[model samples]
Target: MTHDHDHDHHDNDLDPMAARVRALETILTRKGLVDAAAIDAIVETYETKVGPRNGAHVVVKAWSDPAFADWLRRDATAAIASLGYAGRQGEHMQAVFNTAETHNLVVCTLCSCYPWSVLGLPPVWYKAPPYRSRAVLDPRGVLAEFGLVLPEGQKVRVWDSTAELRYLVIPMQPEGTEGWSEDRLAKLVSRDSMIGTAVALAPEAA
Candidate 1:
């Protein structure tokens, strides 16, 4: 999957915030106060062009360079900024690395506070109350909904993003890529993986 390119997986209005936004969009569109096409175009740009590619490159670099990965572990904001990915909504960042025994998941229970600079705009589901509440209460079940069924023994750590800080999940690099370049490896890094809803793509999948 390429932003692990999925945005249409769900269309639930599970929260008052989300429902209100949809209602406002409808009202605005009806009143000609906003252009629905333009709105879609902007969301599409963020979903496809802005965030996923830059985040993928960061993941690839971490996968390729141990020194950089160490720096990322120590100072994620600086490490990510070093790659020129820092901007509004991403000033404070923390990188949580996934391992064989552990997995990471992120959500904003209060609101959709996300690392927009790195992950682009938060997906609709991420902002909905169902996902926000369920991610913390039933992280494994949420992952299963995203098609990521972790092993029973694998620890699932849930991180809550707030107004001041956000988290990026550093997915485990795929295997059998010893001789591959960063660019090639980036192809295997999906946005969903960085979001911790899924794993990095398999080489064959890439």
Candidate 2:
């Protein structure tokens, strides 16, 4: 490859993050801990995360109030907005509830279109090609990859997110707590749970 023209842009000229990445990559490569070619391959496959607090609140409310849950089911965008959380990438939202017989998984097959307002940021793996394809082709297998194994008779349904719409999974309420407070229940909702890669944690686990 030709580096003749690029050398004019020195390390100091690079952006802070770019400079740091270059430095780290060089250090790892020289130490034999990483291969530069492997690093390139990783970069080639990667396309493009946040805390799930907002989505957790939505899940908590759904678990605590039946009316809100019904509203979420009928119209997730307006329901989520009712709680004062609405913005770009979350304009059109759909809530898929996980039931005893069925599980739901969300993926953006085209690109990383996510419900940022509610779910925060999309995970890096969510933007990768393998997950986008396999999510729809083999959702159960994908869930198992995330360490969630559904029962034999249970079915897995994949929701494909697009530029205009996104999905949020409402996992079933865990057992052993009939009157758990919303705050307590919120703790049981993992980011992955709302993504449908896993179920809500049980009370003991929570």
Compute each candidate's TM-score over C-alphas: 0.76, 0.77
Q: Which residue runs of candidate 2 sit more than 4 Å off their true CA positions?
A: 1-11, 16-50
Highest lDDT scorer: 1
* Candidate 2 lDDT (Cα, 0 to 1): 0.85
- The ten-residue window of minimal lDDT in model 2 covers 42-51
Q: Write the per-residue lDDT of candidate 2 for residues 1-206, one digit (tens) a residue.
A: 34566665755357789989989988988899999787777555332223477799999899889999999999999999998777644369999999999999999999898887777778899989999999998898898899999999999998888778888999998988678887888899998999998899988897
Q: What is the lDDT of residue 111 in candidate 1?
A: 90
lDDT of 1 by residue, 2-40 (tens): 245447886443588888899999999999999988999
Residue 82 shift from truth in candidate 2, angstroms: 1.1
Q: Which residue pairs of candidate 2 clash?
A: none
